[model samples]
Target: MQTTCACHPLTMENRASAAIIVRLTGEYRVPHDLILTILTVMLGATALVAICHRLGLSSIVGYLATGLLLGPYLLGILHESETIHWLAELGVVLLMFTIGLEFSLPRLLASRQLVLGLGGAQVATVTLLFGAALAVAFGIDWSLAIILGGAFAMSSTAVSLKQLGEQNELATTHGRVSTAILLFQDLAAVPFLVLLPLLGEQAGGIGHVLLFTLMKAAVVFVLLAWTGRSLLPRVLHWVAESHSLELFMLTVLAMALTAASVSMLAGLSATLGAFMAGMMLGETHFRHQIEADIRPFRDLMLGIFFISIGMQLDPAVLYQQLIPILLVIISLTLIKGLVMWLLIRGFGYQKSIAARSAIVLAQGGEFGLLLVSQVISIRSDEAGLLQPVLAGLIISMLLAPLLLRNNETLANFLMHSGDKDDAKNAIDNGAQGDDDFRDHVVILGYGRLGRGIARVLIENNIETLAIDSDPRLVRELRLQGEPVLFGDASNPGLLQQARIDQARAAAITFDDFEHARRVIAQIRRFNEQLPVMLSHPADHDDCEIGDDNVIVFDSEMESALMFARQLLVVAGVETSAADLAVNSVRSHDYSELRGVGDED
Candidate 1:
């Protein structure tokens, strides 16, 4: 009876095992649900990014916070693994590649003094000073200290540039200086990346490691440069001729990934290779087209990268080291600001511009995280120690947008007294006395097109008053003995300052359509009979120009006429006919053509 019971139990166990195997096979049939979940998370993250942008915060911070909230430590919607890590790494590679495309060699060469000289000095000085401080204060070894200092030496190129662009300051004196310094920081990141492996090495020979790394980097650079110069242009030209956007995009991605892999295999930073590849292609005619095409992918991947950064942050670690993190943030900001101020001032910039430049570049950058990760990879035992530094970097990045948002306010406060004096002197130096300024033409916006219009008017003996929002441009124009007001064109007070009521004709030379419309409406409200002419960029298609009360000249109209003339010339048409056609279009005489029927 005992034997019979044992045999029956064995048969039941075998049947259960067979049933379990069948269920497992069914589960492995497809992975549709896993892919759907990932897509859902990505879309949710993107939505959060948009919401954050609407709320006036950096979208990067939003994406990162979203990732953290949904990650394993929080709601557990997503889990960290090798696959996710690999995707995050790809995001970074693509980001660096896109940045490289923007970095042209000629542009760097043109600003070498400011970029390489001041920028390089700032990085070196801040690195040395902070590194020494960390070593003495925390009793840390030189290698870790150097890594920390190098991390702090970088500033967020994305944050600074975005803010400057929003304020239309990229073309201003302060913007140029900031850009030059940031460019240097970008190039300096290459060496710092190479040095990371050497820092954590057990071997005592730092020189040998560095030499090998440099040699590898040099080889990668030469390879990428040669391929880009000799082959990429032809490939792009052929792609363009075929007009296959899909093929072009695929080719770009393949090239970027291949170059990155080559750099990695060569024992160098993949970012360095990607950047070099971008720089090489930046010389081609298809650069802008490539930029436009790659933007969507870059933006998506960059968002993912930022989110991954947030998800990696352990809240427990952050909370425990809050005070120390804050201290590092403050110290890093102050030290970097001081170094930048001195460097920019040494370059002969005014105190206000220099100070602004300092504020813009005072934060830690994204590459700092990459450098720390690289270091950790080489020395796995020290991984836990990087937690505080990573926390500090995140805090600094979060604070960067806030500091930059208030840069204009800070600059104005610092330069208020000097600017007032300059304005008074400007008014005193004007040729027209307060009594002789009636019936003058008020031109809003002193940009390139506006200035050209002003010149033509001046040559015709017309007295003109120009109003521009950019303080630097206004100052320069005043120094050149021109009458320009330093204020917003849409401001009613500024219009009154320019004697708009007494002006016989007004010109809205601003490129922004909304600003032009506002200025025109305000002028009409102030002076009903003033003929207002507006300027536009070449791409603006729907410009409303009709109204007996106002005379508007859309700049696109002129560009269209010029383009037509060029096409006619290219088709072997006579120059006289082309000129006649262009003149007719410019004067709006198309209605007088013999075959043209008037629908209205």
Candidate 2:
């Protein structure tokens, strides 16, 4: 008698398809199911993310939505599988690794007042308050409540930072505060990650379990630290000497996975190991390169992880627990915002700064989603609260961008700072002081080029002021007696503070053409006839400004003209002739050379 195969029909069909594709592809067998799945995921993700981009929403929303639509509860094209699960976890590991890479003791020390003082207080207090509320109200285990609280205390770093950056607020007081708090939150998540699995593995005897986990972790850390200090640098140095990007990338991947495996063998979470590995590597000079190489892998894995999260939301559960989810969302935003404002205010910040910073952080974070998902995975029986909590976290993230966009306005209104113009003037005055600058050259982007221009202007007794986005750079420049302000040049308020209206001319030295364009546009709004100079790459798209007063300094074209002039003079042509030829080329705006490579 023939034995019956125990495989499902779908599995058999997938196997059959794979077999046919293997035959068609050639000697190197490739499974069709894998290809199909990848294609479906890519297509879905791209379409959804594109829509979100167009709608001015975060890409995270699209990713979660993609998972929801394709998940088992909906279209059922993607289902829970061991392979997907492992892949999702890998994404989490990589993400933790990157976060760890960003950890710098010196940077933390530099901003200790905000980073350690305010940030530490925010995390500790918020976590305790949320934990206490959850435990008392829901009657859950204190361990689970603490985990949930830690999760809730996290504000989306990606959302707040990006929104503030787009609004040109990163150099603002509130922005600095928000950044510090977010940094502490990211750091705080690591311990929670280490604790979660330990809590799940041993249900009761909390103190014993905590002691045991800490002991094991300490041992692992000692071993890894000693080994990593000696081993990782040598391994990485040898890999780098090979001059093979592919090989180097493979080595880095191996290092991360190997560290993770070691942690797993030690009965600790793999992400903890990865984070440790990243921290070790971060001390080395190769940190930036390693970060760049690992980003694509991290991003892909993260997308899968989020998709897996989306799959966990059962439609029936979402519908049944809609009210609870809404309540959670409301609490995550409004109540959390109030708590944050109080915390910031208590730290001696002004009401406006406190309110703005609080509003910026009033939402669930990606890390929160990660923690909630991990909880759901470990505690299957806790679905009632877990599902609604997870759903609420996702929805709150969806609304984060909207909240962040209007943070300043809301802060002003709530804090009763002033009307729009009054608030604007207040900020302008705070940023600029009472210095009256007139008929001076306003330089945007105080990088290499901007510094050079400022030096020349100063030498010629032409008054100049520079604007740069980097706070550290701005501070350094200020110490050297450079009239530089730390703020986004694209911001009209910042431009106005730079005295763009009274400036004789404005120069945009930013390499990014788009940013330069925005700066130029803002400058025009203040002084339409101000002779504006834009520094850009020769290959960049032509500016649409069409204003004769706006001058384009194409680096490539300038270099070519200099080369031609020198060559002509060297090749027996008169100096006057060479100058004339160069001037002719310049007069046509390098149209002669620009036309030569137009095909590309």
Please name the candidate that would achieve the greatest lDDT relative to the true structure: 2
Number of clashes in every candidate structure?
A: 0, 0
For candidate 2, write residues 1-600 as lDDT tens digits: 999998757678898999988787877676788889878988999999899888878777888999999899988888999988999999989987887777776667877888889888888888889899989988888889899999989988877887887686766778778988998998888888888975564466778888878888898788777777899977877766665668877988898888888888987888888888888887665565577668778988888888898989887877898899988898888888899899898988778888888988989998899888989888888888889988998889899888888887788888776756534432423332223576899898888889999999999999998877664666567777677765567767667667788899988888877777778787888788999988876655665567889888787678778999999999999999999999998898777777675676
Q: Give a tens-digit lDDT track for model 1, residues 1-600.
A: 354543444478898998899899977777876887687787778788788788666777677787777777787777766776777777777777777876777766766787788888888888898889878987767777887788888888877887886665665667777877787777777777767777656547766777788888888888899998999767766665554568877888888888888899888877777787788777754454466567778777777777777776777877887787777788768767877788788887777777778888888887877776566656666655676777788778788878788875675676574464332322223233322356789998888877988899889998888877564566567678788765557666557657787898988877677778788877876688888877664333456745576655646556767888999999999999999878976576443332333243
Segments in model 2 whose C-alpha atoms lie over 4 Å from true places: 1-34, 201-204, 419-600
lDDT of the structure predicted as candidate 2: 0.82
Best by TM-score: 2
